[model samples]
Target: MFKKTMTTIGAGVALAAAGVLASGTAAFAHECFNPNRSEQGNAGASHSQAWLTVHIDELTAGLPEDDAECVLDAYAATGAPTSFTIMVKGAVGQDGTIASNNPHPEKAGDGSGIDEIFAAHGADIVGSFEECGVPMPF
Candidate 1:
């Protein structure tokens, strides 16, 4: 009886561990798309409207470190308040909408919202990054 109970408990623990591992992998998997990439259509026009989107929670998953830096740098470029905003407040659903807390009006998968925000505001946010003593990845 003791042996059987131990075996059952061990099996349950192993199954639970497997479940956790699978969920962890899924959590890291993110889908990134730029509908206006240079290869897609009009160069300038497409690039201008571009934004980067993922599960709002996984903004940097698929993107290269440099690309992520560039996105932040561009956000630094945007002035804000006077211009548009770029933020990741919530995940984009299959129906393609965001949470009410998300202030940006644009939909996901359009372009790098950071880029758009920078293009519109043209402010410098890198100062804060610099203050933090973190080197820019881009």
Candidate 2:
């Protein structure tokens, strides 16, 4: 029957498609040899480590508003990073300190990033960092 033939072809197509998708997912689940991933995903599973805690407050004695700050670490592919940046979200004054805080990082937004408050230290650098290499894909 024509209907049976169509069903058979459909099943074959589906099986082939599934195999391709599975292979693709397996390839990407780890790391793939894509030219665009040249930047680096993680610092490598095994390497160096560092930590910093930032603090925050009203730099001025009379301001009612409080501020948040960040402490960061620097790790180069081979050695310590000469310098790094803690990109402050929104507009924070120019005088903030880095430290560790409670509940670990209270990430801002949809948790796209993480934040560690040194609220206990009243704002001080108290976090760990690491540096590693980008592994080659299988």
Candidate 3:
């Protein structure tokens, strides 16, 4: 009887562990997509929207699909240095707020703070810019 009870307990523990892992995986499975031209124009970036639209896929490569999409829109919309800085700052602010994270980095901030987060976390995007002939100002 004791053996049967232990087996049942072990099974329950395994099931519980699986449930936890599944939930964690789900949390990280974000989806990214291409932005419409209108959305790209609205990104408020100083960099050329034309350039961003053409090279977005290259810049965003190797990132989570959703993160790539976020970077594309953010980069395209950055209409000025200040806007670019704010978008980068916002993306960084939302890094720890996993539950609230989304593709719209610009929507995440009040536009205050340093914009170095991209330098640390945006290698693919930055590299794409360099390869495509429009390196970031940082």
Per-residue lDDT of 28-95 in model 3, one digit per residue for the tens? 11111112224445344414212111123333445666665565656555432211211111123555
Q: Candidates 2 and 3: which is better by lDDT?
A: 3
Model 1 — TM-score against the truth? 0.20
Which residue runs does candidate 3 get wrong by more than 4 Å?
1-54, 80-138
Q: What is the lDDT of candidate 1?
A: 0.32
What overall lDDT goes with each candidate model? 0.32, 0.22, 0.34
lDDT string for model 2 (15-118, tens) is 33322433441211111111111123222311112211111111111322221211122112223222111222212241221211213333211212322111
Residue ranges of candidate 2 with Cα displaced over 4 Å: 26-138
What's the residue-level lDDT of 120 in candidate 3? 22
**lDDT value for model 2:** 0.22
Error of 2 at 119 (Å): 45
Sorted by TM-score (best first), the order is 3, 1, 2
Our tally of clashes for model 2 stands at 23
Candidate 1 clashes: the total is: 13
